[model samples]
Target: MTILLYDLVGRDTARPFSPHCWKAAMALAHKGLDISTVPTRFLEVPTVEGGVSKLVPVIRDGEKVVADSFAIALYLDEAYPERPTLFSGDGGKAMARFIERWSQLTIHPYVTTAAIMDLHAMQDEANAAYFRQNREQRFGKRLEEVMAARDAGLGAFRASLEPLRSTLAYQPFIGGQSPLFADYIVFGALQWARIASPFRLLDDSDVVAQWFERCLDLHDGLGRKVAAAAAAAA
Candidate 1:
């Protein structure tokens, strides 16, 4: 049976911009599983699979419905042992956990500030209003005000990626030779920024940017299929 992925999108259903959704999508691709995506808007998320979760990146495989991108990846790996492994073993799983936390703590805040308004712009009017209000309440500032400081934080953001840069210098991927779930974890984060914002988050000469380009070319250009906001507009 084809997996049914409830992927988050904004006004453009073709653009599934949620980082978590991208993680699940990439994991499914890595596992060589067939999938059909259900483009879910913010407001429509609560209605998916009868309120499976407050968040998206939900997948239904046969009779088993799974929520959360990490859980979905775990499920896919266990269920399809014959297919390509997401985490090569227990050690990889442990490393993936660390990388996930590092990406969230070190990478997410910067990208959120950099792309929050662009994310709002992609939403429909209703969702945009909700996003603006909710995010403003969370951040204690308007979306524009939040994004305005992105330029100042750019250097710190780049510096925070030194560990990843060091790793990429030694190997082509986070998974060494082959891309793994760890690669997808970071890829999903940057891919969110790429799809939502025109901001240049990384310098062209940065190894992190080069690594991302390599990731974009994986799964037969899966990440590249959704053009960046600037490219999409062009």
Candidate 2:
């Protein structure tokens, strides 16, 4: 059976390489699953219209539609049980689940904010225009309004980093020595934030920085894919 992933190739605002999606993609890649990506602009339209819901990183295996990143990860794990398991046996699986929840509820917002600020700083005019056009297309509102909403979202985003900072202090990976499903989810969001935007929040945090580097190393091939996408976008 073919695995189809709905993804965004590069810096498209509507279908940005969200961590949630990244987690599923990386997991599938790591498992050596037969996968193909179908690029989409905004998740909500394809999800709702296509019956996948507003959730990104939807994985379709034949007629089986797996929505939600975490759910998709679990499905992939069941489909392809292999070495380098995304989740350890029992306890590890529980921990992985917790990390996934934490990343979504806490870490993602701050990383996203930092990324946006970073992107704005590096390529303000171009990025702004890109964001405006994308937002207008997806949200159907004035660019200014979207920007204002983004600005307001920053406070919560900043707050999200604290849990990650604390979590990383103890473990190399989110779940422990080996990266589990949780790491992939968090990494995707962090990577998107760092890559699409310009923020280097990882710069100051030694543990988080090291962890991020490790994640890049783990999915070196996917990194190349992302680089190629960025180049193509450029």
Q: For residues 24-70, write the lDDT of model 1, one tens digit per residue.
A: 99999999889999999999999999998999989999999999988
Question: In order, what lDDT does every prediction score?
Answer: 0.93, 0.64
Clashes of each: 0, 8
TM-score of each: 0.97, 0.71
Candidate 2: regions farther than 4 A off: 9-16, 47-49, 115-171, 228-234
Q: Give Cα distance to truth, residue 20, candidate 1, Å.
A: 0.6
CA lDDT for candidate 2: 0.64
**In candidate 1, residue 196 scores what lDDT?**
95
lDDT (0-100) at residue 159 of candidate 2? 56
User: How much is 125 displaced in model 2, in angstroms?
Assistant: 15
Clashing pairs for predicted structure model 1, backbone only: none
